[model samples]
Target chain A: MPAPQKHVIGLVFYPGMTSLDMVGPHQVFGALPGVELHRIWKTLAPITCDDGLVIVPDTTFSTCPPLDVICVGGGLEQRAVVDDPEVLDFFHKQGKTARFITSVCSGAEFLAKAGLLEGYRAATHWGMREQLMTNQGVEIVNERVVVDRNRITGGGVTAGIDFGLTVASILCGEETAKMIQLLLEYDPAPPFDAGSPEKAGPELVEKAIALMQQMSSLEFANPVR
Target chain B: MPAPQKHVIGLVFYPGMTSLDMVGPHQVFGALPGVELHRIWKTLAPITCDDGLVIVPDTTFSTCPPLDVICVGGGLEQRAVVDDPEVLDFFHKQGKTARFITSVCSGAEFLAKAGLLEGYRAATHWGMREQLMTNQGVEIVNERVVVDRNRITGGGVTAGIDFGLTVASILCGEETAKMIQLLLEYDPAPPFDAGSPEKAGPELVEKAIALMQQMSSLEFANPVR
Candidate 1:
């Protein structure tokens, strides 16, 4: 018989989560032969993504099996993530049981608030780097991905795919990760050169900032205490 | 008043649809401002992706509004996409109503089968190129994206993102697409050199072909008649 599947990945989804944060990595992890990918949320019912793409969870938070890896994504509804005691409690509990704990973009802020990032190096979306820096005992990194001990972190939404692949490599060996990467052609070509604040011209970055200003104010008012 | 929130884009989803085909594009399209994205299915209930991620539809087929653009994805469930008269009827009707009709991977096949591709130059997932060719008047191109009049097509799962951004340029203007691309920092770095059949080394290509051969019997048995 085929070798028993060795690992299971649990991806936590919440309302307003960035679809790419889950999808980019889901493609990488699902491609593995012995891996099972689970979408987890408060309920098994379908959850709407930030942009309105609705997804159903494979398991509700209460029903999730022991996970080898757990990934939480972030987006416009981050306040919910930051303030939901049940979600924070769940992460705090699972972070101890799981082999690895990971977060993409502002999700790291949630992890940090749960006290999981204490004394660990982490990465987050560029927009939130300042917020991360203020957290005690967390060494914020500017790299696209930062791996400290068993905690893996990624910058912003798109970087989740890269971080997921990196974690897959660490858990399953580089060969498996490479195979999945090859299959998906993870190499991307953008017609334009702007993705980061630094690369995006000042004018474009300003637009992004202006667009996000209202949301940022919400974040400030609802800071994780 | 603000430029009246441009327009909304509606994407159709169904059971067994390739998640990447839709999610990849959702990433790019969902990030834009003045644009609302919706996931529409026959029901507002949750659906499972071909790879196991479950998604909820924003609107039922009967409720979806007149859309600015409609994208239909395809996968192993091509038969369902091509043969369901209700689905075909919806595509046909929506194709005429929407400003653009688009698809990714075997999604092009659905368009061709619906007679939407008559006189159109299209692209699809390489795996389904031959199948698409059997349809009269459908010009299958090998490029990553094909644009003919109002129909836009992408080569495969990952190609959907590229195609979405391309169509974004056409619908919203090149500047909007460029800004979003920069925000995504859409630069991709694939660790493996083999992404396409032509570029993947001979040995790896042979391995892929061998894998494909295993699926040939299934394909022949399930050909959409």
Candidate 2:
């Protein structure tokens, strides 16, 4: 009978993070009515995304409110940030109170590093699935979206749409998520059949793995975050 | 042999534009090697998207260079922007020099207004398919991504990814586009079948049409730009 209470969602944006990992879900979650969204970072200064796109943070780490949900996106810089005590501590503190703790792509690594994904089934970017498996006490599931209780995780890049819709259904309802899906015109029609390594065949997958390896090596040699 | 020259891509940004409409292609384009990317607008100011996300423009309309490719995304603001002579003229000027002039979703409407899509087969958001067909000289096709010579148009929001990859193949070659696809891990597995009107069944499509109508009306009543 009354107006729906505003739900606050905090989206973590870091230097060199993937744009689609966050923006995909941002487009979906932010479209909901009475939603309070915050793009949180250590500072309010603009942060360059993994691919050269620039995004300005809407809220500082210190000023960010206790969120109903927290989402972290992944990119080339995830390897370096896993050791940042500040980020890990923030995740630990927020994960304690947030209704749902979520991650997209390599963002799961941050949660895995923070011990949030320990003992819970999770999903990460398939390219980095091997590295994620090295994390002790975490179970890796192969799916576009993986949901275990309050911990929700989406696979790499574009999977954020599925992740957002699944979570929206849980938070709002099936009708709401479906409506948002329509609003997004989310009927995906991928022109190519080569979205995954399996679909791409061995040759393309080999090249992709080599490229990912090269990127990781470059990140270590010349860190962006 | 010297290194290949950077391919400049200027993506048009405007207030009330859909974030994913631009960000989707941006992630794909920015991932390419030697991509000199520019997020151009009328001025170098922060603009709010149709959703709540805020993005800062990287270049101004006056300062934008002769680009290899120019992309424009769409949203509720399409109606008002199509009437702006400066924007229409800017598209006209850029279309003359740019190798490829492209658009996503209702962004095709602006190109139509500018007379660039005249006599070209184009794709647009299905919800606004009728309005786009009103252009006497333009041919409206229902495909997700339509490429007629140098004019490339994508259907709806999510189609930008497909559009980007298809264009990338044209510009950089299929190998580069395929590599980028693997890197992005773009294996899309939508949990719902209701992405398009035909796929979404009659009831959902009816509701989606009504929602689109509501959003356009709301935009007219209270312009965000």
The RMSD of every model to the true structure, in order and in angstroms, is: 4.2, 4.3
Q: Model 2 misses residue B8 by how many Å?
A: 1.7
Candidate 1, residues A1-225: lDDT per residue as tens digits? 878467888888888787887787887787666787788888776677776777778787788888999898887777766778998888888888999999988788778888999999998776677777788579888778888999998877778767877887887776566555544544455556666766766777666655565544423211111
Where is model 2 chain B poorest over a 10-residue stretch in terms of lDDT? Answer: B216-225
Cα error, residue B149 of model 2, in Å, equals 1.3
Q: How does model 1 score on DockQ?
A: 0.45
Alpha carbon deviation, residue B133, candidate 1 (Å): 3.2
Fraction of true contacts kept, per model? 0.39, 0.67
lDDT of each residue in B109-213, candidate 2, tens digit only: 888888899899999887767767877489988889999999999988989999999988888888888878877778887767667766666677676666667
A40: Cα error in model 2, Å: 0.6
Compared to the true structure, candidate 1 yields what TM-score? Answer: 0.88
- Which residue pairs collide, candidate 1? A54-B56, A55-B55, A55-B56, A56-B54, A188-B188, A194-B182, A195-B182, A195-B185
lDDT of 1 by residue, B27-139 (tens): 78876667877788878767777677877777777888888888888765556556888888888778788888889877887788778899999987655676677775898
Provide the fnat value for model 1, as a fraction from 0 to 1: 0.39
Measured against the true chain A, the candidates' chain A TM-scores are: 0.91, 0.94
